[model samples]
Target chain A: MQKHRGIRSTGIPENILGYLMVAPALLCILLIAIYPVFRTFSLSLTDMKMQFPNMAKYIGLDNYISLLQNDRFWSATYNTLFFTVVSVALELVIGFVMALIMNMPFKGRGLVRAAVLVPWAVPTTISATMWKFMYHDQFGVINDILFRMGFIDQYQSWLGSTSSALWCAIIADVWKTAPFMGLLLLAGLQTIPAELYEAATVDGASKVKQFFRVTLPLVMPTMLVALIFRTLDAFRVFDLIFVLTGGGPGNSTETLSMYAYTTLFRNLNFGMGSAIAVLIFIFIFLISLVYIHLLSRQND
Target chain B: MHKSRWSNIIFYVGVVIFIAIIVFPFYWLIITSFKPPEQLWDIPPTWWPSRFYLGSYIAAFTERPFLTYLKNSIIVATSTTAFAVFVTSFAGYALARLHFKGKNAILALALSVSMFPGIAIVSPLFLMMKEWNLLNSYIGLILTYTTITIPLSMWNLTTFFRTIPADLEEAAKVDGASPFYTFIRIILPLAAPGIFTTAILVFIAAWNEFLFALTFNTEDALRTVPVGIAMFPGQYTLPWGDISAASVVVVLPLIIMVLLFQQRIVSGLTAGAVKG
Candidate 1:
């Protein structure tokens, strides 16, 4: 309703007025969010370790080159991608089913919906630690349940080994984040008109047929958007892995973000750390571009 | 009718499974928090604690300055929420109501910034904070948290403000009310639900934030809940019981908030997510 007229009574231009309204926020964001990013790029090229403190010299492309050849960096990248792909895939299927169930005409649906959000609302650090307790080899309930269900022969350390540690972290991530995907997809489901379903029923389509023909087609865009969002979040995951395994069992669950954190803080290698950080930023930027490209193609 | 009945059964089964997956972890968190240290390492984990033990909770309070952690968490979360909401309201209002140049660009930039890896900037931001004498302080953590939360809140509040009816603002303006007056009195009151939703979301994020809290706050007195719990040291052993109790303390407020405001949280989440 507040249209941008050419000029106000005091002769202030409309564009300037709009800019003034948004300036404070934009300034905060630029100062806090955007500027540090550029600074990170500058730090990546220099050998700046916290321990050294005095000598700060730019050795251009050396950080990036060394990082590219580093086995630990490559391994961390693999772990990150593997975790993101697997967790996002699981969350997609599980979340879609959850969304469909939420859309159904059922008693206590509101209660069920609220119940589902418990996982998403719980902090990642807490959930990761909670899962760490649950995965304890000696006393974990997971091993107990699995042994009872004849899934595992004996109690095993879920986070103690390199192979199983990443999977364990993945499982925790899936549990925590699937509800977020479900919430997003449920929003998409709510937009569809009931008349479409009625029409499908009148045409003698089965429920499965209706889902494939109507629901899937209609909700696919939303599903992809959710996928992209989850992918980005998963790729940069640090808290879950940090708390669950500390990227341990020999860096089995190490992600790029974890790698960056370790180098920046633990090792105090700011030069290499910033390089990893910039690579992460570029990876996310590229992934988002691909997703947006797909989105635009869909619009056409 | 038979087909409908079968489908109903299937629906109920799905609901059961979904609820089970979501609720099981929290149930374990609660049970673990209450379990005695001995029971915690039992051969087969006890599903229920032995007679509702309160030792862990007491330890959570006494052993290490956990109450300090709680106090700091509350301060940081509340401050970050208040600051983020206050700052984003203007930008959100402009994006939603005022037509301006570079609006879409600003929105896109904000969205991109949302994806900016917080880890990437931590080095510089850390150095900057140290230079500013803000490292290990509430203001440092709050300001950093604001940067992360602002983008998400901006997108959410912008979408939310756009949903309010335009006619009300038009009527207020027709009554010769100043733009600021109308925004403060008419528009803001109307956007209460959106603002509340955004505030809760930001609060939860700041409360849960670990890296910034852990990196910035080295002093035990200033540490927030997540960092405190993560860095919680034990004298004799790993202190699983105390850690569990601390986890519960960190998450219980969030669980309560989520359950109480499920509808608004869901809507807020969906609104930001749907357009993506």
Candidate 2:
């Protein structure tokens, strides 16, 4: 194997063969994923509108300049950031607890795990719809349960109120994703050797102490990765919020992606929409950078 | 002993609560799908449906053109899975087994592409599809879906392909078998489980995809499940019953897949994260 590692018997050098093999997949990604990003960036630079394609001209960041002054854009940014932080935080805590439980040697663990994945398996849009129904003010199950339990005198408008709309979306998101987060954390938990716990126990470390000292530190990498995955996902959230609230009750639930969608498709202001798209990309890129840095630092 | 017993009781309670929270929404969805419209909007919503009413399911198909949506979803998801798996298998093989410069760079690029927001590119893709007259077509959605699906498939297959020992290929080479021949005959068979897992994950992603489907396809016949359910008529008065029925139809297959291959899905999903 070492002898033939440098060059294959077929005389197509390994490096050249590698390029040949990856070409098709690379082409697809470049054209579809990479090229469109560049196109969006370039489009953001021009004053393009779907309504007047012939009148399109170079605008040189005017869209972005105006976007900086746009109150709606700022609100959307705040909403996206708020959603990403709160949902990811809740998911992490809930998912960590769920992971610890699933990691236990319990009967019916398989069944429980499968049940937990039910939310993850459901489509996001469906989840949004289901939660929307549950959060309905008058006839919603949430209201019924709360009212029946004497938690509230009357059913409250969850999605209809600006104060609660984003929270409702957040709750729905955490419900759909906490299981997935738990699954990821469970994988990390499994990677910890059994002997580590045994040794900690021998040292007379209590459960809480051992968790803080051993499991928490060891699972940090997985947690960070899962965090970034959910963070970016939450930042780009569209379908759930779109379906659930439509960014309603005075645009309280509007996200950057929703703003971009409304601009590009609904208003047909291609230039402004492209600018929002570019901004979304930049924000996501910064997030990836920070996490990658943290990840690498952790590894070292 | 008393303390441990109390802890055990608490643990069981925790487990029960966890299961209930995760499973209740799904149970409600199924229950609502069977309830009559009046029951659906009752002052105190019925905990359980009085009878199995098939009206919602009947309406979902008969009234909303759900069959066409299901058909389109299947075609787009299946094509995306096949094309992504086929293309990425070779890339994965090369990354895993072959000596190559720029392999890490390519992997990084793929990873970043996976993170790229679908919303960011939807407009340009819409325009591109328009120019090619590919909008509202299966091919357009499939091609776009591949871009999102390929990265994960590549990473997963690469990770899986690396688990396979090179000795099999070495022996094949000693027998004068070509590299391509070894990959096709030996590596692929050994990597079948990994490939299958990747295929399932890709299919689910493509199946659940909403943004591109919403943007590129306006025609009802071309709408995927997510889009169809999202764009359901009766905007003023939402059709919770029909929507729930459609959601059940769409989610049932996914539930079955997760139940049957829970282990494989876990491994595939965590491949990049845990390993990296």
Candidate 3:
């Protein structure tokens, strides 16, 4: 099943047939992915703004240079990287633990798996809003629970302060996305054979030892895949941050995407926004290259 | 045996906490939607609503164009699903069945495309849409959604199509069936389950899409449920009740679907992830 079953052709060669079949989708991808990227690159080189679309001039790398010197841009870069690193690291740990538990033989395993996916299934904005409600200073559920247990003297406004706003955003993000990591890792877990564990057990290996030696090696590729997906997604965090804090209290939670969005839409600064957009793409590209390098090396 | 019993108890406890972390927000959202305004801000909170209140849901419909938003979301999402299915099916089949010159190249290209930061294209897409007079149009949004979904759906479908044994298609070929005829009659029917699963996946993705929907369709009449909810007007102060009600309306169906099709979604999502 690694290769698709090829049929015996009578008239047309397989190459031509393949081209004909793939043409529509390839065209759509070109229009959808490649064209916009090329367009963005061109747009980045100009002084384009929505209000004065006709007054645009070719500004060679000015937007990029200016963005480099801007403190706000640096903060967004730092914030995005921070969110990506912290949330992804936490998600990997939590998701791995959840995956291990889900892989355990038990009653109601199916139900439990479904329960774990609920958070991922909910829309991001909705999840953010749900957390916002729970983090409400005056009547939030989290505040109520913490206060009742004597953990706090009184309720606190979680999203209103600069210090805690980004972290709160991260917590909400981790809650919504950790299940996605769990699901991907669980898929990896299921693919490892039970016989490996049996063999380890026959050799008198402890469960912990077997996990390190047998399970980890077998599932590393799938884990890498999950890591790459989650990292890329975390780097582009938008809806949750927007709905939760709106880059808030004072630019603390402003991700690259949020900054680009505000520049493009709110400020109507298309040229600078495209430059930020390009920078974000370069960051993603570099990150993917690093992971793919790990991927290729793993093949050895 | 005694140790195993202790491990089992620990495992169940772990599962309970996992479920709690994931599901509590949804529970809170539902409760908040039904709580009367007075109980909403109660210190220590009324753990449960005294009565199920429909006031917020009523307000959601009356004060905002909530129902219209639902209609708009359905239109764009369904259209995107249909377009995705039509294109990805043929592309998946080609990648799976026929030996092509750039087969590996196309697969790798699709994988890289999946990693693209969508916001990178937002500015360009906005300008392009405006130039084409497509801003605020459903067709414009549908086109964008279709592009966003193509890479993953194609990868998923290609994986799925590979699972169909070659012998069945060869048998159809032996019966003098044209290749197109064989695909139409044999492969398409067998691929129904995969197509349905992919369609559901794409539909959900498009439904939850916020960035494009927010920017492209700025008109009040064309807003999707998510943007509609996020951009719902607040007067004087924040409208928590109405917002919660809209969140419930948007999320409840997805939660129900995930529960009903848990196995399908989990497998489809994992397949898309690992293979991509």
Candidate 4:
């Protein structure tokens, strides 16, 4: 039935009738997605700030040049990459393992499967706070557990130190985000037919061999698809870092989104904000292009 | 084969530990919410509350107009979701089913628009909202959220709508129903899962939304859950216990909804990921 459903979408006719059918939504997407982005590009060229919008000057890529020379932009760029690369890579590995575990036949698996999603379901801000509390210097759950185990005599201020805070933020992110990766990969795992694995088993291929030869190849595409999604989201993350550390302890956890936001809102420097916005957009667009290429192959 | 059975046990145990780690923060919140103010900050860290105290929620209710904020969030979220789904379905149906002159181009344009960072236009949108006098109003938040939500909802729902058989629509039309009625009666009902998925996805997105809610709404009366929680800690700082309890209160519903309808929600999320 599903196979038949896929092959026969060709019969629907195009009509002004069909166009009228969907105009409201098309217009909304147009105005929201396309128009504002273009406006942002235009706004990037101007010397606009909060004080006076009407008397803005068009300086033509000077903002971009100034952003290139700024130490803060480079720092944010490095931090964003560190966050994205480490988190997405870890998520992919952890998520794949969890996906494999959940696919196995077991008792009370339903309950366990549902429970794993709780972290993913928790709003990122709340989860950050949850972990923030857990990581507190004196009274945190993490400190309690570590203290009980005699890991250290003195309490650690996880969010206070410059060297450790960003990594701590990454840990909070990984804890909340890995479940999401696991779920996406698990769905991918379900799509691979069982018969191939059975045939491999009958041939006396070792379980690891069967997995490498069959599962890994089949799941890579899906993992690639999932990776693109997580990376983009991680790159744009603001609320979690904002609430957890406020990009604090000497700017250790600042990402492009927070920097752009602080520039626009805190300093009211629209020009610098728009320049950072363009840079982030360019980086995302380049990666998205790679994903789009992968997608094109998948569709074909 | 029997040798690896031990490995299977190892895998299950490992998975259990992982899931436990995943769930503990939220579990902590629940326990914290019902604990008394005095015991909220236990030194040795009490694993469970001896008794459930309902007063934290009461204070959460009484300390501020909790119900009013909840109502405002619902109205804004519901309206945005409704407008978004209604608009996206028609637009998605059109893009998917109709042979528009710019069908492929339209889809490409939609995808491209998503490239711009939300912060870039935020200033402009902020200015635009102020110019139009929508700051602090539900209408303002709704419009701002709608811009993001509509694109988001449409992108995912369109993928689902495109999968439906068009012959069903054609048959409904052949029975003398206008295309509008046919869409309303035939296509929409069959697309219930997609619609509901859209609703759940939109609700969570709206409920979790923060920047606009915080920056756009100045009055205490207009805050939503995210903003509510952001301000929650400050308001009850003197009583650290109540603040933790209230943080739990703010997030509890979202956690519950996502856990209960987890399968649907995950699928909706991946549809966004997989397609976009």
Alpha-carbon interface RMSD for all candidates, in angstroms? 2.8, 2.5, 3.2, 5.3
Instruction: TM-score chain B for all models.
Output: 0.92, 0.98, 0.95, 0.89
Question: Candidate 3: where are CA atoms >4 Å away?
Answer: A1-13, B1-3, B272-276
What is the Cα-based lDDT of residue A6 in candidate 4? 39
Q: Candidates 2 and 3: which is better by TM-score?
A: 2
* Interface residue Cα RMSD of candidate 3 after superposition: 3.2
Per-residue accuracy of model 4 over B1-276 as CA lDDT, tens digit each = 987999888877887798788777877777777878777667867778879998887887788666677788889989988877777888777776656587777666666665545765676677778889998899988876776777667777778878889898888655555555666667778888988988888877777787778778868888876676666666444444555666776666776787688778878877755333
Give lDDT tens digits, candidate 2, residues A132-246: 8889888789998888899999889999999999999999999999999999999999999999999999999999999999999999999999999999999999999889998
lDDT by residue (B99-131, candidate 1, tens digit) is: 778999998988888888788788899999999
* Among all candidates shown, the one with the greatest lDDT: 2
Ranking by TM-score: 2, 3, 1, 4
Tell me the tens digit of each residue's lDDT in model 1 across A210-235.
Answer: 99999998887888788888999998
Could you give candidate 3's per-residue lDDT for residues A9-104 as a string of tens digits?
345666787898888888878887889999899899999989999898999999999999999999999999999999999999999988888888
- After aligning candidate 4 to the native by TM-score, how far in Å is the CA of B192 from where it should be? 1.8
Clashing pairs in 3: none
Score candidate 2 by TM-score against the native.
0.97
Which one is best on DockQ?
A: 2
Candidate ordering by DockQ (highest first): 2, 3, 1, 4
Question: Taking the tens digit of each residue's C-alpha lDDT, what string does model 3 give over B1-276?
Answer: 999899889888878888877778888888888999888878877678878999999999987899999999999999999998999999999899987689999988888888888898888788888889999999999999998899989988999999999999888766766666677778999999999889989999899999999999999999998888877747566678888898898887888998998888888999965553
Q: In candidate 4, what are the lDDT values of residues A58-142, reduced to their tens digit?
A: 9999999999999988999999999888888888888888888888888877776777677766566667777777787766778
Model 2 residue runs over 4 Å out of place are A1-11
